[model samples]
Target: MLIETTAWGKLEIDEDQIYHFSKGIPGFEDVTEFALIELEKSSFAQLQSTQHESISFLLTDPFNFYHEYEFDLPDTDAEELDIKDAVSVRSIVTIKEQLELSTINLLAPIILNPLNRKGKQVVLHKSSYLTKHPLWAGNSILDKGGE
Candidate 1:
């Protein structure tokens, strides 16, 4: 299947690579189908909408930045996506003037059950995490290659 993406142009992806999000991402409730495009040599991946060319999100493993980052995955929400145990957790990233100034959205992480190809963005109601937590202590995104 071919999908038009804003960042990657025309992309050919397998049918199984498409993810169905019953509740879509926050603020994007209309788009529920997305394809995860792996970025070159980087932990970041493009969560591109297969329906809209402009609807795409840059996602990354939050643990790459905040190792201690942990949150609750309510059983109720997990059951909705049919998530039993294993999960693919990723956080949305907001790039600033420079890559070194980027911030990760640890407050709400996207959790996906690959076995079912279903996902949901769970927002932490009361938590210390932030939507724009600095990528690291200081200038580490470029200094350490975001490792």
Candidate 2:
């Protein structure tokens, strides 16, 4: 299927690459369907909304930057996504003017059930993580923006 995007322009996507966010991402509750496209030669992937061409987010495996990153999937959320065995977790990447200063959201990671293509951005209420954490230089929060 072909979908229009603001970043990558019009591209063909496979059905398997699509994920359904029943309650939608935090701020984007209206948009539910998104295509997870992993960029070539990169550790990041784009969660592009299929319904809204302009709505897109860059995602990355939190573990890639934070080896110690850990979070327990609430039983409620796991059951909602129908996550049985196959699960995927990703963090939303926030790009900054200074490329090195970019951050990824650790407080709420995007969780996915690859087996059923269900997804959600589950917020960790018990974690010490913040909404913005440096994508590199460990998992410490260093945003001067005071987020």
Candidate 3:
């Protein structure tokens, strides 16, 4: 399974590594298949669209930046992915950068099923969350506490 990517160029991916997003990411409902590729020695990953070479997202675990972060998907979403246990769930946030700070889309997290290679970008209904939450600001909070 060889495919061309926006950032990684041409690479080989296992068929099993291909993830099926029945309802693709926001603004990309038609794009379904994607493969997760990690950036070398970095916490970031590229969610490369198998359907479109130009369509790829930079993603990371929000928890890595914000320890207090939490998200809960609706029961309907869980059923759609056939999710049974928490162990099968992996969450990633789309990265965004501003002039002052770097942010992550916490309101809509990409959830993946490692075993079945299925995924979904779920929009959380919680009011406390934001589409662009500052990941770096969260770290600054911890630093202030340490001081």
Query: Pick by lDDT: which candidate is best?
Result: 2
lDDT of 2 by residue, 81-144 (tens): 9988999999999998877778889999999999999999999997999887887784344635
Candidate 3, residue 40: CA error in Å? 2.8
Sort order, lDDT high to low: 2, 1, 3
lDDT of 2 at 89: 96
Order of candidates by TM-score, top first? 2, 1, 3
lDDT of model number 1: 0.86
Reference-based TM-score, model 3: 0.82
Model 2 sits at a Cα RMSD from the real structure of 1.7
Q: Count steric clashes of candidate 3.
A: 0
* Model 1 poorest ten-residue lDDT run: 138-147
List clash counts for every candidate, in order. 0, 0, 0
**Tens-place lDDT digits, model 1, residues 11-67:** 899887789998788899999999988888999998889999999989999988888
Task: Flag the better candidate by TM-score, 2 or 3.
Answer: 2
Q: Which stretches of candidate 1 lie over 4 Å from their true place?
A: 139-147
C-alpha lDDT score of every prediction, in listed order: 0.86, 0.92, 0.74
lDDT at position 16, candidate 2: 100
What TM-score does each of the candidates earn? 0.90, 0.94, 0.82
